[model samples]
Target chain A: MECLSDVGFSGATVGVVAKRAGVSRGAAQHHFRTREDLLTAALLHMSENRLAELRRRAADLPDGAARTGAVVEMLIDAYTGPEFSAALQLWAAAANDPRLRSQVIPLEEHVGREAHRAAVDLLGADETAPGVREAVQATLDLARGLGLASLLTDDEPRRRRVVGQWTRMLEETLR
Target chain B: MECLSDVGFSGATVGVVAKRAGVSRGAAQHHFRTREDLLTAALLHMSENRLAELRRRAADLPDGAARTGAVVEMLIDAYTGPEFSAALQLWAAAANDPRLRSQVIPLEEHVGREAHRAAVDLLGADETAPGVREAVQATLDLARGLGLASLLTDDEPRRRRVVGQWTRMLEETLR
Candidate 1:
């Protein structure tokens, strides 16, 4: 994951990743036959880690109005940092690579669904209600867009204000 | 632009782009000193085209309630298709390449602010009102996130639903 985030997909070759992990190239090859295998495993590992982190944070979320704000914050945090960076690299590469696209699409769909389910739970949102599901999706999408903005620069000040606004909007929608 | 969208950053070398453009490599190099120059120019060209298209669409938008929905649809349209796909490739490459990052950041900032301003204008939104600016920003962000989603799958059905929900939210917020 670090390899992908730091050097990007083009640079994260098996030899480089193996060296980064302090493992021999042959040993890395023994575990994963191709670069695709290695990359998919890395992304999967990162996704699981992200879900685990979200669950961990949810356990400690405050109740009531504060919970909505906390949930928005958690979702934004989920889309930033090294893990998201790695995923972005893969996503960009996968956009043009057929084999990588096939691997990434399903993984992304699973992660996206899981994240949506988690958000629904964290926000105490009832999806059956009109506009409820789309509202939750909008919130997730906004978080992702904010993450993309942060990749180029320190978008925190603007991002914070946006998050504050979104939290209020989400609270109203869920209510 | 097509090269970037079709083949990605690594594949859209000057030689390849020139070939696609039916120009000699030397002629391409004469116009753009490096691949970075060519890409920046392409992105700039695309941005200008997008902004012009937005203005053209804005001129025809209906008055009152329907205008908000039209504006939201326009915003979502701005973030999808080949132009956005090419930009995505550059953005991903720029994330790790400082030279490209320096160029892309300012360009993106310019494009983002212009899009935001355009949205504010089209919706007749009052940014001075509390949360109004952030609401506009969120709308743009959601459009961008939806664009990312569509890169891998046909997300139009869900995207349309989200846009519908957002149009309502935006209408209320602007009110």
Candidate 2:
């Protein structure tokens, strides 16, 4: 998926991914019976990778405040990182593919739920409070958007500033 | 740009757009000397159209609250609307083209500026307030992201709820 998204998904061939991943074409074939299967697996892999990365980044943080801070920084890094760029590109490709959409939507919802839960735990807020989860999720969603937009522009300073502002804004909810 | 974006800018031939817009090939060529030019012009044109729609929507309401409310709704509509989907597809294409990026980046910045300005005016907040602009822009960005995500999933209720939550969140920020 990374190779395909990075280079353009529709044009991504099995041979390209095999070569890129340093695996034999036969080995690649064994793993993915078809191109569509490869694409599906890659998308799922990326979603899982992102969630794990978020958790790893927030692991050392003390609570909601620390977690919010850590999560913002991690999210910034995630969006701008080489790996996540591939993921973002895949997401763009999925936006245009119905098969890809079916695979991606539920994962997306699950990720949103996880992030919301984390934010609640981090902020020490009541998960059921009116607008609380929604507000926090909105902040998370906004951070992801800004991060992706900044990545596209290759603007590091802007990315840092946006991330910093987001961390601060999320922290505000704690107060 | 909408046509190009809708179809994947690189994949979208000028011929397709001319056909989609119901204009002659010659007419399309006449208005846009090159495909790149057409894309730039299209995105600018759409932004103008969006701004115009926003103005009309907010026309009945008082300046601050009305503009805030109306702009958020307009943004929701714009992101989910047909034309913007095309523009978004073009955005993906632009990600791969440096020339297209040059055209898109500035326009994106302009929209961000316009959004920030509107928020400031509506909230009666100073632009220089440390995090005010960032927060407002972040919320708008969040709405757009959620809108895009919702579109990919065919979730109308999720879309409606997020849009409402977004408006209410912004309302809280202003207060």
* Clash list (residue pairs), candidate 2: A64-A122, B5-B89, B5-B90, B6-B86
lDDT for position B9 in model 2: 61
RMSD (Å) of each candidate, 1 decimal: 1.1, 3.0
Pairs in steric clash, model 1? none
Local accuracy of candidate 1 as per-residue lDDT tens digits, A1-175? 8998888899999999999999999999999999989999889888888888888888899999999999999999889877778888898898889999999899889989998998998889999988999999998888888888888888899999999998888888888
Candidate 1 lDDT (Cα, whole model)? 0.90
Docking class of 2: acceptable
Deviation in Å, model 2, residue A165 alpha carbon: 4.4
Which residue runs of candidate 1 sit more than 4 Å off their true CA positions? none
TM-score of chain A of 2: 0.78
Number of colliding residue pairs in model 1: 0
DockQ of 1: 0.77
Model 2 TM-score is: 0.85
Provide the overall lDDT of each model, using Cα atoms, as 2-decimal numbers.
Answer: 0.90, 0.65
